[model samples]
Target: MELTPRLAGMVALLAFLPVVAFGVFRTWWAGAITLVNVVIIAVSLYLLMSPTESEAHAAHGDDVESAGDEAL
Candidate 1:
């Protein structure tokens, strides 16, 4: 199965839920930090998985077809 951005984020969030739960049992601040970490990780995964503008265009066969267009 391919790991898309949404899937990766879901996996990361699930993996971190336990840490947040256990952290909450210890202290509120610990739980808060873990929650923040989860958000950051999810966002990072999405950004990393998604293609950039040029990459997206290239993948869709939207790139200039002619070699001469490369210089522009």
Candidate 2:
């Protein structure tokens, strides 16, 4: 399965729900933790949005042939 930004966001948000619920039922600072978790999830999702340079290059078929040619 290919991991994508939307998938990562969905997964992280799902994982965070329990923590948010627990925090709500616990202390105030515990509730504050929900915000921190959200920020982390957002950043992770943002990063996942783009494939790295090598990954992008590999996705295109041309690079693989060029690489093989160079090895000869």
Candidate 3:
């Protein structure tokens, strides 16, 4: 099944909800959920930190001076 970004984020959060609930209720699943959440958060952060190809190109081009003066 094709998953949209919103759906994926929801699924990620939902996956931890049970554990959070269990932890709040003082059940054995507290640590398990915390660990899972940590892993998911780490992965999310990694994805966010990674740059796209266009961003890299723009960064490289940004320092190039314009040639408008040559047209005069």
C-alpha lDDT score of every prediction, in listed order: 0.78, 0.74, 0.62
Q: Judged by TM-score, which candidate is best?
A: 1
Q: Which pairs of residues have clashing backbones in candidate 3?
A: none
Better of 1 and 3 by lDDT: 1
Candidate with maximal lDDT? 1
TM-score to true structure, per model: 0.75, 0.53, 0.38
The per-residue C-alpha lDDT of model 2 at residue 50 equals: 62
Q: Per-residue alpha-carbon lDDT of model 1 for 1-72, expressed as tens digits?
A: 998988888887886768767686788888778778888988999899977887865666655674346556
Candidate 2: segments with Cα more than 4 A from true spot: 53-72
Which ten contiguous residues of candidate 3 have the minimum total lDDT?
62-71
Lowest lDDT 10-mer window, candidate 2?
57-66
* Clash pairs for candidate 1: none
After superposition, which runs of candidate 3 have C-alpha atoms over 4 Å from their true positions?
Answer: 1-27, 57-72
Local lDDT at 8 for model 3: 56
C-alpha lDDT of candidate 1 relative to the true structure:
0.78
Pitting candidate 1 against candidate 2, the one with the higher TM-score is: 1
- The order of the candidates by lDDT, greatest first, is 1, 2, 3
